[model samples]
Target: MKLPIHPIMEQSFAVIDREIGEHKFTSGEYAIVQRVIHTTADFEFAQLIKFSPGVIETAIAALQNKTPIITDVGMVRQGIANLVAQTFNNPIIVAVEEAPVALPGKTRTETGLLSCWRKFPEAIFVFGNAPTALLAFCEVLKNTSVKPAFAIGAPVGFISVVESKHALAKTSIPQIRVDGRKGGSPVAAAILNALIVLSC
Candidate 1:
């Protein structure tokens, strides 16, 4: 189902860039911002989405080098563009759900991420569903000396998502996060896609 880009769509993107320009953002900074805003049609993201200083560059380099992109849920894994995954050999991993550790009262998302972080310490971690997944991964990083490409830590929820993101922001790990509980799998995927496209 490959479709050609329509001229009107090109104009629509131009309009988005122009509208985003009122904020006077430098091209480098807003390019990705525009992508996030474009995907969700939620202009509020322009203010809420924060990135570590070198995160974009780090993400691009990882994608260029065939690094793995790990997600907390299968939805986030599936949301990534097929072209990006195939072109870069950047395998999207979210296999823990099927055979997760049997922890009492723990979501499989939590126990699974805690275990897998040890195995793929350098992979790009994307979390769009579980706050505990982000928390668990960051906790593991606390004791180890592992370095990841970066984290797309946009877990959406009310209970502990904000706190988990706050804890993550305090770490030295490079990351991108939505400041509030208004993100989803598609948003996470769009942010990653933006990085890949900008790298081009």
Candidate 2:
């Protein structure tokens, strides 16, 4: 079922469509781009977002299958919770909150993300606020058989943001990433929300 949209949001989408004329996005890709733009009101996301080959279909299938959803932070979980509940109702695990404390050599999010990986290696992993978590995840992908159903690497910041995205790109996993330091919880949530809508 299609979710209800407020009139204001409807008008905003119309404006975005009119202004963002002539793009090469496929229908599924454009839906994600439009939602990200709608969430941030920044057209730059249209250029920053990247998708791996056949990722959308794979991600949508994962969602429809009720694959668990794991997020590096609570904000990203909160942003997509309602839609998730309305649709697949997949379990949402917040990485940072799951960790008892920061590990000796890892951030709390990273530690928690690794912990989640051990149990739900096939979960949909989303990193919206911690590049360290994304980096850790990529490291796991490199060294192990933990292939996520879908990965979203959109952590926003200057420190390791670019490096994290680059690391994710090197992986063969199905994924969506925001290049550079242009992504955050909102963008990450928007991308997942778009995928949820497509799955419906």
- Top candidate (TM-score): 2
Residue 40, candidate 2: Cα error in Å is: 0.7
- Residue 69, candidate 2: C-alpha displacement in angstroms: 0.3
lDDT string for model 1 (34-110, tens) is 77787788889989888888887788788888888888899887778565654676877783573356478767888
Q: Which residue pairs collide in model 1, if any?
A: none
User: What TM-score quantifies how close candidate 1 is to the native fold?
Assistant: 0.89
Residue 179 displacement in candidate 2 (angstroms): 0.3
RMSD to native, candidate 2: 0.7
- RMSD in order of candidates: 2.8, 0.7
Cα lDDT computed for each candidate against the true fold: 0.79, 0.95
Write down the TM-score of every candidate: 0.89, 0.98
lDDT at residue 99 of model 1 (Cα atoms): 39
Model 2, C-alpha of 195: deviation from truth (Å): 0.5
Clashing pairs in 2: none
lDDT for each residue of candidate 2 in 64-99, tens digit (9 for 90 to 100): 999999999999999999999999999999999989
Specify the highest-lDDT model's number: 2
